[model samples]
Target: MITEFAPAKVNLSLRVGALGEDGYHPVDSIVVFADWGDALTVTPSDALSLEVSGPMSQAIPGGEDNLVLRAVRLLAQASGQDAKGNISLVKEIPAGAGLGGGSADAAAALRAFNRLWELDWPLDMLAGLGSQIGSDIAACVWSQPLRMTGRGERIRLIDDWPDFPALLVNPGVSVATGPVFAKFDEAPQTGAAFRPQGDLIGALQVATNDLTAPACAIAPVIDDVLAALAATKDPQLVRMSGSGATCFAIYPDEAARDAAAGAIRQVQPGWHVFPIVFRGVSAITPT
Candidate 1:
């Protein structure tokens, strides 16, 4: 049996562009992974089978439509290999919290199956196959901090990224990505690319999530969550991570982040407040 980790994705900086001729949305954003996320295990089997279990597993579908299954099928067909295995998904990331939970699961499956089937494919090769399953899959395959553009197929690794501490808070609500993009198109913004400043906080000050406004329109609770994070005495920057509902605040150090998370949890007990150290291009270590 082989086990692979599916880290929760967080868009440290997301900039959405106009709809493309292919009917896909162009996006430029910085994606990060959380050390604490879903996990998947794969073992050989005569037939493809899947079992889902975890804190957030109930919210995920256990069928062919699941991204994990689709990823396996796509890779098998593309590689001309038999797609037979027993796949188990242990979901920890929120389903529709703009955390790229499903995408990460699919990426993890691809990674596991590549080795399970002895494909010995590299990250780029696996990411190419992942794009067929979903746009986010390509980015999730790397599971690191990188710039995603051109409908999320483009991946550029970032350098000299500061190790900022982050607090991710979800107001126990789900925000669908499709609707958020649709709303953005209804009344689009200038939608420009992110320009990095000398410092992380400086760069963050200029970058923003284009889908935040529309997302708030769809789910008012998202606005409340943002306000709550913003109220934190003095966070470096507070904004919606992706689309909506799950907002993050970057701090100068881990101590500050933990304090902020604890204070928010005390006030919004129902919210899912997580304190993590943002290891850019790496995994977020939980506090």
Candidate 2:
């Protein structure tokens, strides 16, 4: 059996532009991964099968629609091999919260099959295959601090980013990405290029998510979550992640992040709140 980590992906900065000819919105964003995420285990099998467990597992689909199986089958067909496995996922990240949880799981499966099937394919090959299925898969496969643009396909490393201690809160609502992007007012042809300056943390202070407002418009609870995070003591930054529903607050220290989580949980008992460290990996971990 082989196991791989599918870390929660966070968009530290997301600036979306107008829709392209392909009907996808172009975006300029900075993405990172967290220590908190799902785990996928694969074992040789005659056919593809999957089982999902974990606090958030119930929210995921168990049928063919699940990306895990899709990724495995796609890799098998593309590589001209009959790759089959029993993939077990311990899902920790919330779906539809803009954390790229599903994409991360798919990427993990691709990495797992790359070894379990003895393909030994290069990282780029896996990434290319991943892109066909989801926009975030390539970035999640890399699992590092990336400056992502062109609908998330074009990626470059953003080095020396601080692993800011953060509090992620989801107000028990899922916002559809399509509608959120559709609601973007006067969407431009493309977002301006991002230029990093000064300290990474300080640079993030000015970075923004253009989808935040549109997401809040779809799910008003997002505003409440943002407000609650703002009330936390001395937070460095509080903002909505990805599109909607899930929001994050970066703090000066781990203590601050934990404190923020506790305070929010006390009031929003039903909401999902977690303290996480945003770590960046330089390469993929294949097992």
Candidate 3:
């Protein structure tokens, strides 16, 4: 059996542009992976089947629409090979929380199958196929810190990224991405092109997630989540990770992050709060 780890994809800074003539929103962002996420395993089988079991498994669909199945099938078709595997997935990331959980799962499946089948396909090839299905898959396939642009397909690795101690929080609600984009379309921001600043923190402070306002409008609890994170002691940066509901705060160290997590959990017992040391891109090795 071959196993793969699907790390949570976090967008530290997402700068979205207006919908273009191509019917896609252009985006510029800094993305990183969290230490904790889903796990997937694949073994040879006469038929392709998937079994999902985890804390968040009930939130995921285990049918043809599942990204894991789609990714394996796509890889098989593209390689002119049979899609046959007994796949098991343990989902930890919540769906529709803007963490790119689905994409990360797909990427993990692609990588696992690549090894299981002895295809030896490189990351770029797999990422190219990933982009055909979802915008975030390419970054997830790379599984490192990068600057994503041009609808999230284009990526440039960040070599000098700093290790970030982070606290991720979710308000026990799922916010769909389509509606948030639709809301932004009603009144999009008009501004000059986005550019990175001197340092990571400075760049993140200057930039912002363009979908935050609309997401908050759709899910008011996101506002409360952000407020709670900000109220924590000594957070270097606090913002919504992707679209809504799930927010994150960067702290000076792991102690601060852990303290913030405890404080938030105390106030909102039902919410999902996780503290992690987000390592530099070079240090993020696949497990």
Candidate 4:
């Protein structure tokens, strides 16, 4: 059996480029994995099957259409290997909270299958397969700080990014990415090009998630989360991650993040909130 960690992804900075003729919006974003996420285990089997369990497991689909199942099948087809396997997904990241939970799971499956089958495919090949599943999948497969563009498939490595402490809060609401993109009146046509300046943290401070406005339009509650995070006692930059629902506040240190998480948890007990460090990989242990 092979086990892999599917770490949640946070869009540190997402800039939407113009709507393309293909009806997909191009994007330029900096993505990072989170400490909180899902776990996937793969065991050889005569048939392909998936069982999802964990705190957020109930929210995921168990059918063959699930991204994890699809990902394995796609990889098998691409590599001409048997796709039969038993995949167990232990979910933690909230669904549709702009955390890229499903995409991460699919990427994890690709990585595990590559090793299990000895396909020895390069990471780019895995990323190409992942692109068929979801735009975010390729970025998740890389599982590092990257500049993503071209409908989230184009990836360029970024070096010298300093770890930033963050507090992520999800209102437990699913905001569909489609609707958020639809809400954009004037989207970019050309891809955004920019160089990282100063320290990684400093560059992020100047960057922005272009989708935040449209996402807020689709889900008003996202504004509340952002506002709350912005209102924390310590000075922090609050922005909506990904398409919607989950928002994160960047803090200077871990202590500040912990204090912010505690304060927010106390005030919003019903919300799914956690303090995490933003790095290339998640700090949370995979189930």
Candidate 5:
């Protein structure tokens, strides 16, 4: 059996450009991995099957439409390898909260199958396959902090990224990406463009997640999360990560993050809160 931990991703800096002709938004953002995530286990089998279980398992789809199953089918068809396997997903990240939990799970399956079948496919090829599953799936395949642009398929590796600690909070609410994107009056039309300034950490502080406004509109609780994070003193930046609902506040160190988490939890006991340190791209430590 092969096991892969699909770590949750946080968008340190997400800039959504105008909508594209394909009905997808062009994005320029910096993404980072967190210690919290889901788990995927693959075992040899004659037919493909999947079961999902975890704290957030009940929230995920369990049928053919599940992204994990779709990913496996896509990869097999692409390679023409008739591979089959049974996959078990232990989900912890909140679904539809903009944490990219589903996307990460699909990416993890691709990586596990690549190793299990000895396909030895290049990472680029795997990532391209992932894009079929979701925009964020390709980035999750790399599982590293990167400057992502052009509908999330374009990635640029980042070095010298500072180890910033953060507190992630979700209000146990789900927001749909489609409605959020639809709220935009005009699709952003910036071509693939990114200008990195200062160090990785500083560059992230300067950049912003443009999707926050629309997301917060759909789920006002997201605004509450941001307000709660901002209430804590010394938070480097308080903003929503992706399309909606889950927000994070960066701190200089773990101590500050821990303190912020504690304070937020005390006030919002129902919130899903986690204090995590940003793992650099090279640190592939599984969640």
Candidate 6:
């Protein structure tokens, strides 16, 4: 059996631009993955199959539309090999919360199959296949701290990225990306023009998610989620990740992050609160 971890994706800094002629919004952001998320296992089988089971598994589809199947099928087509595996996915990330859960799962499948089939493909090739399926999957394929731009197709790995203690809270609500983007089209947030200051934390302080306001408009509860994070003690940075519903706060240390998580859980026991140290990876050239 082969096992893979699909970490939840987080956007530390997301800046979206006007909708382009291609009917896609241009985005510039720094993306990271948490230490916790879905877990997947694969075993060689006569035919390809999938089974999803987890706290949030009910929210995911188990049929052909599932990204895992789609990703693996694409890989097989590219490799001219049969896709044969009994795949199991234990989902932990909330669906439709803009955390790139589906994409992460698909990336996990690609990575797992790369080894399961002994393809020995490079990350770049896997990411190329991922990009054809989802905008976020390519970044998830890398699963490292990187700068993503051009509607999420372009990526440049950040070298010597620092792993920071952080808190992620979901208000037990799922906010779909379509509606959020629709609301954004109605009245887009003016993006702040800025550049990476070499100080990642500082760069993040100046950056913001353009989808925050629109997402708040779709789900008023999102405002509460952000407020809850802000009320925490000494959060160096507090903002929405991706579109909405899931917000995160960066703290100076793990101690601070854990305390904040405890306080939030005490107030809202129903909310999904996770304390994690965002993982970092060495730099690579832009792809």
Candidate 3 or 1, higher lDDT: 3
Residue 10 in model 2: lDDT: 90
TM-score of 1: 0.95
* Comparison by lDDT, 5 against 6, better one: 6
**Residue-wise lDDT of candidate 3 within 36-138, one digit each (tens)?**
8999999999999999999999989878899889999999999998999999999899999989999999999999999988888888889889998989999
Model 6 agreement with the true structure over 1-287: per-residue lDDT tens digits: 98888999999988888788998898888889898889989999999999999999989976778899999999999999998999999989999877899999998899999989988888988998999989999999898988888889888887678888999999999898988898999976657644577778887788888899999988998899889999999899999999878999999999999999999999999999999888885222222
- TM of each candidate vs. truth: 0.95, 0.95, 0.97, 0.93, 0.94, 0.96
Model 5 lDDT tens row, 1-287: 99987888888878777766787778888888887789999999999999888899888987788899889989988888775999999989999888899999999999889888888887778889999769999889888778788889987877667667888899999888888888753444343455777665565566777878778777888888999999997898888888878999988888888989899989989999988877775444232
| TM-score (C-alpha, index-matched) for candidate 3 | 0.97
RMSD of each: 2.8, 1.7, 1.5, 2.7, 2.3, 2.4
Task: Give Cα distance to truth, residue 145, candidate 4, Å.
Answer: 0.7
Q: Name the 10 consecutive residues with the lowest summed lDDT in model 6.
A: 278-287
TM-score, predicted candidate 4 vs. hidden true structure: 0.93
- The numbered model that scores best in TM-score is 3
lDDT of 1 by residue, 128-151 (tens): 889976999998888877889888
User: Per-residue lDDT for 79-135 in model 2, tens only?
Assistant: 998867898999889889999999999999999889898888877788889988889
Q: How well does model 5 score by local distance difference test?
A: 0.83
Report model 2's TM-score to 2 decimal places.
0.95
Error of 2 at 260 (Å): 1.0
Clash numbers, per candidate: 1, 1, 0, 5, 6, 0
Residue 32, candidate 1: Cα error in Å is 1.4
Predicted candidate 4 versus true structure: per-residue lDDT over 1-287, tens digit per residue:
99888888988888787677887777888888776678999998898888888999878876777898899989999888888888888999998889999999999999888888877777788998899879999988888788888889999866656577889999888998878877774553343555567777667778788878888877888988998898886746788899879999888788888888888899999999988777853332222
Clashing pairs in model 5? 17-188, 18-187, 18-188, 18-189, 19-187, 19-188
Which residue pairs in candidate 2 have backbone atoms (N, alpha carbon, C) closer than 3 angstroms, thus clashing?
18-188
